[model samples]
Target chain A: METFKHLVNILAHPTIMLTVGMLVFLFFFPPNDWFEKWNRRLRLNFLWTKKGFYFVMFLMVVFFLFGLTDPNFSLIIKKPDNVPIIGLIFFVFIFLWISMNQALKNDNLIEAGEKPEEYNDPEDKVLVWPDLVYIEFIALILCMSLLLIWSIGLEAPLEGPANPAESPNPSKAPWYFLGLQEMLVYFDPWLAGVVFPSLIILGLMAIPYLDTNPEGAGYYSYKQRRLAIPIYLFGWMILWVALIVIGTFLRGPNWNFFGPFEFWDLHKLVPLTNINLSEIIYIKWFNRGLPENILVREIFGFLIVFGYFLLLPPLLAKTAFKKLHQNLGNFKFGFFIFLLLCMLSLPIKMYLRWLFNLKYLIAIPEFFFNI
Target chain B: MSDKKKSNIFQRLGESQVWKSIIRSGIPRTRRQRMMSVLNSVFLHLHPVRLPRHAVKVKFTWCMGGLTFFLFLVLTITGILLMFYYRPTVEYAYTDMIDLGEQVPLGIMREIHRWGAHAMVITVWLHMFRVFMTGSYKPPREFNWVVGVILLTLTLLLSFTGYLLPWDQLAIWAVTVGSNMARATPFLGHEGPGAALLALGDINFVNIGSDVKFALLGGRFVGEAALLRFYVLHCIGLPFIVMILMAIHFWRIRKDGGISGPT
Candidate 1:
């Protein structure tokens, strides 16, 4: 049991969890068809099948039941504010399973040179008065009943009165914004809070514009949009939902990590000797006093930041994203690549923070500017 | 005999001037009548007279969009009820929350409102996920998708603004942490990147007294003013904006050819 707890704790770490998420995504959606035969032989694609879904759900249920037996895990999971998050986790998985299951089925049909399931639907048109309206009415009633039950079962959280002086140990934002709060750990408030959020909204809005592919426009088919689907899943699952989970359950006193079975000890100290790029260059590597001039001091950091945003787009267009560039033209391709790079930067920054204890790429406290 | 009499009475009532004036098309019993029923009613007209059968499939759409709207309506209704007993002032805000939970009749209104808000957030996300997976945002639906993204942001903002209304330790701190991000709003924030550059001969334009954060909080910190501001945004300002955007979103769905289907 102790060993099991330790293993779970290790797996729960953001680095490990994200690595696993990437691997699983790759396993399910292999980049090349050459891996298909190997995957079939290994029966790995069974994970995307109905039986696999049920098996995974069973495992999740068992895990939850076992975790609930542990008081520490139960305490966190049973919290009023955390309850919706628990539901969110289940809902995300269930919905993902449902959509993926259908997509895979549709993919199979399309591969056999047949129309997708939606195309074969017999009743092409339906009356709004009875068909759609009936569904809407039923859904509304069902939703209302569910809300009533949920409200009755659990009381909304009401903590102590507002006292500015007395702060909570682990002050968390609302569950939805927890992802942004988690990002604050790695990036400055400007980048994490303001810039990234705007980019996310912009990127989502830009999807229709960027994705010029006419295929898979109105149906579920993974094979038709292998690239698009996986990228979206990665953003939604790992970047957004997983971060929320980490922020809600793992983050404890002073925003320290606490495993599900572990106690949130206030005094549990982890060494944090975060160094900026300028400090690393001047003080550590060169073994000299830092320059007085701000621009001169942070020249290396500035160069790297500029190179990443400015140079990388054209470079990537020539190399990795050549096909994408050809498809989306110049302006659209540039915008798409920029957004993609920005999205990828979050994980890159996180990895840097974990591996090197690096704080800011460009840290200029003179004007409170850091990245 | 009694059942016949009741039916006759209902039929007569349906044919009466008041009922005719209100219903226009009473008890739709034919195909044309069904279509007319949807067309004639203001509430029902939001949906088209006919839809692709697959569009009504629970498996495909997951009814997430409808549920999201339903949850929003629930939130609005319950929010109104809660507002009757709740006060936004710092002194009364915390006490008012306590009273709603403890003293008010049907105190569950607060719970329903809170949970409904959370549910709405989840449903909206799922709705987006569904739309993306189905590739419904393609072609003519592109602008609608952008509208949706804005709605998603507004939904989050609505929830975030409401988060401070309870005036509890959780509320104030969370808002403080959230609003603190405004302090780094590039050129606008006091501690932001270009704020220093905005200064002229030691006369700094952006500082603690005049920054985005100060504007957001109505002061340097999350106090009474901040609470009131958040309350107004939560209750009126954001919702009003959301309603306008939502109108465009729904209208565009019809204009863009009613939900996407297999091409």
Candidate 2:
């Protein structure tokens, strides 16, 4: 029993004496350059590639450092109070163990002279890391640091412990969702969440279909490329930006981006008149002939606004499609017109509500439970 | 003659639609070919004939997105394990959460599930942004881009739905506000034009007048009904949809020539 206990201690102790011993022995011993030799024989460089291999190793070491420093055992241990130094140590060993295994596999492959195709550069293409990588990496690092400081240390004060009964006024969703939420404040719920999101999905899906020129595949797909599609997408993006700005800047006291902008209350921001553009388009044009007029009017407000926003894009898309066929002379012309129509329509849709007192378009919370 | 009579497995596999071409060729020529031919039969279908090797190389993958997927898988595993002990009833839900924190064997599982969810969201978003920035959403792979966007939405929805399962005050009201926000959805939302049509006799047919709150709760408001509805959506419905979409997304990757970017 004492002997077993000592063995266990040796195996599991912080020093990890036995494991390190095995690792050291494995790292140094049995120098098999067989794979390297095989590569030489085949002119393959099977276990070669100097910079790539080094970069991979650097990555492994970085991962190791992260494991050591942060030690993500909080999920397993539930001790958010203190960092798990022991878990970090164990994780490091585990990572090292995996690395060792990978190394051994590489060594064995070298010995067997088994060269994978990746070992041979097909084009001998000059591989350069794009300049954007560093910029993105820096941005990422900044964002991560901000989040860590906010969540872990003293940046934003943690709102007092979870209070179930009282929801903080204008209780916001996460920032990214703020854009979507802001859209909701303006439009109907379905349009904000489902239709708009769905349209975004469909738009993304349509990218392949719209941008057919293969020349724009790898790089420089952005320049003077087909007019309509980019315009449509860009317009969509602009709307999102506008919504985010409105969500953050222009919204009333309740869901305002910066706490309580007292320029106007919810009432003014919510245009509650009869003549919003979206309403006119929907009530007059889209739902023109539907009988049961009285029954429809109650929901007509919702229907007109919803139908115009929902259906107008496709109708305009059809017009764009028709123009694509009729005026084959200039693809860009058709595309730009389609984009213009969509661009004009949505803002007009938004403008009608904002300027013309289309408060009915703003689906109040009561509508949620009533429906 | 022997020198000229070469049979490199790597070369052959490296060759065009290697497995498909082999299968179409009737029989394997040798032992190595046979082994590879079998692997090619099963796994090759999951990928394209040739994946422009450097394209998917780790440098391009950036490991961050992959790490996020890894964490998601971990979260799924640990979440399932925790679910075995967690009862999603309003009364027991919060208690289960606390219990998991205090009593669950590893307790790390719960923490992992929690933190992993957060990490997965951040990673997936970054993945989308990376794809966008690289112009990876361009043609041939456009549909896949859409799939990715859907996947991102599903991830957010999953996180939102899961938020309520903790059954804490934060979960209840946050979701209340969130769903209320959903209630304002432009086209389909009840508050928009759709609400009147969705109702009948002062009872919402959509929710039987329950609305999204009622529909979500199986009652008029956020109570036990809401908890159960969110539980099912989070655990079963959304995940199922996501998994199906994810399968389609991955398969499309191979079909669309594997991560279109700077070659």
Task: State the iRMSD of every prediction, in order shown.
Answer: 1.3, 9.9
Q: State how far residue B254 of model 2 sits from its true place (Å).
A: 1.9
In model 1, the Cα lDDT at residue A348 comes to 88
- Give the per-residue lDDT digits (tens) of candidate 2, residues A1-371: 34643453345321243235333322222123543344346543222245444555677566444433432311212323112222323333333233233334444554576532234354443212222233345545654454344343321112333455677655655433556776654555565665666666565555555545443343222222334323433443345433443443333346532211122334435333455333465566787643344334446555764576566545655674554444443454344344344344445555554455554443334344211
**Predictions in order: chain A TM-score:** 0.95, 0.43
TM-score of chain A of 1: 0.95
Per-prediction DockQ scores?
0.78, 0.17
Q: For candidate 2, lDDT tens digit of each residue in B18-78? A: 5556464324445444434434566334433333444555434444555555556666787
lDDT of each: 0.89, 0.51
Tens-place lDDT digits, model 1, residues A1-371? 98998889888988888878877666676555755556667777677678988998899889989999988899999999898998898899888888878888988898999988887454557888899888888889989999899999999999899999998999888999999999999999989999999999999999999988888978887878867887788899889999999999999999998888889999999898999888889999999988999899999989998999999999999997788899999999989989989999999898888888889888898777898
TM-score of each: 0.96, 0.54
Best by lDDT: 1
RMSD of each: 2.1, 19.3
